[model samples]
Each structure stands twice: as C-alpha cells, then as structure tokens.
Target: MWHELFLIPFLTGLLLAVLLPVLGAYLRLREEWLAALAYAHLAAGGALLGLIGSLPPAIGGVGAAVLAGVGKRLFAARLSGGAGYALMLLGGWAVAVLVAANHPLAERLGHAMFDGQLYFADAAMLQLVVAGTAIGLLVLWRLSQQLLLAHLYPDFFRIRGLSAWPTQLGFDVLAALSLALATMSLGVMGAFALVFIPPWLAFRRAASWRAGICWSLVIGLAAYLLAFSLALYFDQPFGPMLAIVLVFFGVLIA
Candidate 1:
C-alpha cells in the first residue's frame, strides 16, 4: 500500500520539474520562488512519509526543511549563492545522524525510503501517489495567479491586500508534504535530486519558461532512465546512482 503511494509523488515531481519554470515564466515570476516551492514540497513529503512509517518524520522532514529554509533565507541575503548546497549538506548530515541513532527501525525504513525496489511496489502505494498528485495539481492550479503575483511583486501584492506571509506559509507546507511523499516512495536521494536539479539546469540555460520546462522534463527523464539502467547493470543502489547520473549530466552541461 505504501509503495503504491510512492508513484504519485514520483510522477508529480517529474511533471512539476518539467512545467514549473515555464509556468513561472509565463506568469512573469521574477524570483526563484517556484524552485523554492518545489524543494519545500519535497521536504514536506519526506516528513509525511516518515510519519506514516512510524518514524520521527518531523525531526527529519519538517525540522530539516525549516532549518534549511531559514538558513537559506538568512544566508542568501548576505551570500550571492551556494546557500542551497550548504543546506543540502547540512540536511544530509542531520538525517544521517538521526538514522544512525534509530538503528533498527532506521535500517528497515531506510531501505523503504531510499532503495525503492520498484518491482515490489504495491497497490496502496499507487493509490497514495495518485491522490497526492491530484491534490498537488489542484493546489498549483488554484494558486497560480497568487503565486505569480507574489513572485513578481511582493510589495504590490501586500498593497493589494494580499499577505505574502500566508502564501509563503502555504507554499512551505505544501512543499514539505510533497517532499515527504516523494521521499517515502522514490527514495530520499533520488527524490530530492529530482526536485532540485532539473529545474535549476533548465532555468540556467533556457531563455523562456516553456523552453526551460520542456528541457527540464527531458533532462529529468533521461537522468532517471540512465540511473535506473546503470543501477540494474551494476547492482548499485538506485537512488545514489540516479543522483550520480544527474551530476554527470550537470557537469557535462556545465
């Protein structure tokens, strides 16, 4: 049942990775809020999944997401870039420590959270995935205008009687939820990388939002397919291999 729930986030992340940049661009978003939203969703999803698994989901997912978000908000104001990278490293270490401390349950849940043997996926996991995907899509559709407005001109949004704070909070919650779900089913490493990398690369290279999304989707699918193939051939972990594939392509693109 849980494994079935995994597919929803996997497909959702893939779709969002491909479409968000383009959507943001279309709506004239100036900041990287869309990207931030995506990451937040991934974090939230991870937390939720942890909770479902009877693990300390908040400690790892919500806690880490909040910490990472706060750190990014703080450092980004001072540093030009690299805040995300720092957060990623810090979050990884934090999760590792927590996992190590929990040993027994961690070992079992870790395999479920990271290894994700797709062949063994069950019906319940699929249902969860579908439900999550539907909810995410609905939220995205409903909030599109507000999100765009907030991104483009936060001050104006405030003036027009729209509170940026609420929007931000909502986005954060949604992001965390999405992340938690994806992490539970797809494996943490693969899910996180999938959420972050492709959009980033597309944003870097593509001139328009549509172009960026199209490129991102192509790249994301390619990365995952390559990763899966490599993992199968070498008997390596799928999540790490997927991340490596993304890195390899990222470097090549760079």
Candidate 2:
C-alpha cells in the first residue's frame, strides 16, 4: 500500500518535470502562479470530495481539479488572479465544512481531508494511477512546444501573430490534471510541495531554463526516495517525510 502511494506520485512528478517547461514555453505564461492556482484548487477539492463520497479519492481529486481549472480560468478572465484564488479557496473550505456537517460519518470525512491514510490504498488506487499517467502523457505530447513558446515570450508570440491564450488555457488544464494525480497518489502535502519547492530549489541553483528543469527533476526524485525510506523506517506520515526530505536538501543546497 505504501509503495502504491510512492509509485504514482513519483511517476507523476517525473512526468511533470519533463513536461512543465515545454508547456510554459508554449503557453507564454511567465509566472508560475497559473500552475500553482490550478494545483491548489485540485488539492483542496480532492480532499473535500474524498470526505463526502465513497468514490476513490483519485476520482474525486481529478474531477475537482478539472472543475477548479475551468472555474479559475473563468474567474481570472473577469477578476484578478489573487481574487480568483481566494474565491476558490473559500469555496473549497465551504464545501468541506458542508460535507463534514451532513455526513453521519463525519469523523471519517474529516480524516480524509486532513490526514489521508496511505496504507489503506487498494486496487482502485492503482487504476487511478494508470489513468492519470495516461492522460498526462497524452496532454504533454500534444502541447509541449506550444506551451514552451508561449511561456517564454508572450509578447513575442503575439508579435509573431500567435495567440497565447490557447496555450495558457491548455497549461491550466494540464496543471490541474497533474495536481489531481499527485494529490490522489501522495495526498495534499506531496502535491503542494512538489508544485512549489522542487522548482524553487532548482531555480535557486540554475541559471538557465533547461538547467532548472534538470535540477528540479533530480531534486524531486531524490526527495521522494528519501521521504519514502524515512516513512517506511519511522512509520511516519509520508507527506511530512517528503517535506523533511525537501527541507534537508534545500538547506544543504543553500
């Protein structure tokens, strides 16, 4: 069961490491916030859904991710990014509260949102892994170069008579998808840190985009390995174990 938790997120992160740069380039989104928002919504929504339903966490996670991505894009079109994110967070919290209130099994619901038990994974979880990997690979293959170009230079892309909007929209969707997969596999902590810290550590050490991506991949995989090993040995939560791995490497690198 624990291995199941590790394998899905590990693979998903590896795929994201390979794909995000290209997607960013094509989308012309210079800021990382787009991806961050997409992932955040997915993590929050997945947790809420898991609390309310018997559906596999991954399914709930993925569905919420998709909804959040669409909702965020619409919100951003009308409002500022900050406002959109705040609204999404509030909405997620409300849903969680409502779900917890209505359920007779409120205790189980609360645990599902905040303290996912990775050791409880079963065959359905494996199916989610397979599905997520497949969808991610397909999207990456289709949009890599466009995303790279767009993110690298939105104004230049516009000057070249290319519209960056489609690329941005595509990346938003991909980010949500990746977040859903990671959240379902490794839970919220795993997804959140993977979205933030790996890129941060890589950017600190790297001077170029390519180099940053390479470093992010190394750091992400190393963190996962270290976290899994520690969790197995100490019987600790995998999320905190992974966080410690990131912090340890981050401090060493600093």
Candidate 3:
C-alpha cells in the first residue's frame, strides 16, 4: 500500500515543499507570474518532443523551458510583457498536440502530463525527482538574496557591482529548469500546480521571508497528504484531487 499509494505523493510533496516556494517567490517578486503557465506549457510541448526524439522527457521539458526563457528575455528587452510569450505558449501547445496526433502514444503521454499517473512512475523517474529537487533547491538557496535584491531594487542592485538584467534572466532560466523538473512528477500541472495558494498563505501571514518560505513548505506537504487520503476515499486521480484539496485549504485559511 505504501508503495502503491504513498511513494509518488510523498516524493512529489517533499520536492514541492522545497522547490515550489522559491519559484513562487521569484515569480511574485519579478512580477512575471504569468510566465509560470507559459513555461509549463512549453515544458509539456518539450515532453512530446522527447517522446519523438528519443530523449528523456524531463530533458526535453527543460530544453523547451530554457529556450522559452531566453526568447522571453530577448523579447522583453524591447517590450516588457510582450505578446511573444502568449504566442510562444499557444504555439508550444499547438505543436505538442499536433505532434502527438501522429504518434500512437499520444493519449498515454497526454494523460501522464495532465492527469499524472503517479502509481506507475518508474525508478528512473523517481531518481529524476530526487536529483532535480536537490539541485533546484540548492541553486535557489544560493541565489535567493541576490535574486531578491535584483527583483526589489533592480537599479541599486545593478549599481552595486552586479548586472541586474543578466541576473534576472539567469534566475528566470533556473526557475524554468526547476519548473520543468517539477513537471516530471506532477505532470504538466506539476510546474505551477499547488504553487499559488500555500505561498500566498505563508507570505500573507508570516513575519519574514524565511518564515514565509517555511510555512509554504508545511502547507504544501500537509495538503498533499490530506489530498492523498481524499483521493483514495473519493476514488479520484491524485493531481486534481490534490488541486481540489489545496483550494479547500486555501478557503479554510482565508
């Protein structure tokens, strides 16, 4: 039972506890919250590319995310919040669907991305989740203060012997890579799923940034466990079950 029901959720929740809050904080600080969904979509498309190109799905997802991050940064140079992101998102999804249509594994791949077949995850995927989460958290931790300074005091941070534009862009790429790794576990929704609520809950109530981040981790893990039981009782899939439970938790806290 532990192997069947708990393993994937446990791994996912633990990883998210570390990775999600950092991504959320960065997105909120950078005022680029919309990019989360766009990058997730790009990652999904890249997963499709992986299936077609014989690469690891997460690798493809990260590749797509990096490209999207670079393109968005370049385009943002001219027009802040340009239409390029919307186009990239739509084009990515369209391409993924079109490509999937030609392959026999489309339905399975799509189901895995959106619905998250947690019970069927392989050993390689489990390893990916652990390694990805560890790497993502370490990078974010090392850069957190710098990233925050860049976000809040861009000109000042840059004036103090730092390059704000490059730093911000680098953070975005790292964020996309983290999000892509998340997609490997929670599916397409994995990237941004369960992100907004817990972090919002913590950031709203906590006294300091560090405290807020800690609270966010607690909220996410608790929600995942509660949602796991609810999924079993209600006979529902885990991803959407977790989503619903997260919203419930949000409402309760509110």
TM-score of each: 0.65, 0.78, 0.89
List model 2 lDDT by residue over 173-220, tens digit each: 777776665555455565566656676777777888677767776777
User: Comparing 1 and 3 by TM-score, which wins?
Assistant: 3
**In candidate 3, what are the lDDT values of residues 1-254, reduced to their tens digit?**
46645666566656765677667766766666667767777888888888789887778888998888877787786656646657767877787788778886764676677775454566666677777778777877877888887766767764677566666677778777766766656655545655666777777788998888888888887887787677667766667777777788888997
lDDT (10s digit) by residue, model 1, range 1-254: 12435444345444433333333332224344333433434354445446556756534564555555445544655744544544555555455446545666555655655564443334544555566566766776666667767776668776787667665555544554455455554566666676666766777898875577577677878887676667666876666877788888888887
Q: Which candidate comes out best when scored by TM-score?
A: 3
Worst 10 residues of 2 by lDDT: 20-29
Candidate 2 Cα errors over 4 Å, as ranges: 1-29, 33-38, 41-43, 50-56, 101-106
Clashing pairs in 3: none
Ranking of all candidate structures by their TM-score, best first: 3, 2, 1
- TM-score of the candidate numbered 2? 0.78
- Off-target runs (Cα >4 Å) in candidate 3 are 4-9, 82-84
Top of the candidates by lDDT: 3
Estimate the Cα RMSD of every predicted model relative to the unseen true structure. 6.0, 3.9, 2.3
lDDT of 1: 0.56
lDDT of all predictions, in order shown? 0.56, 0.60, 0.72
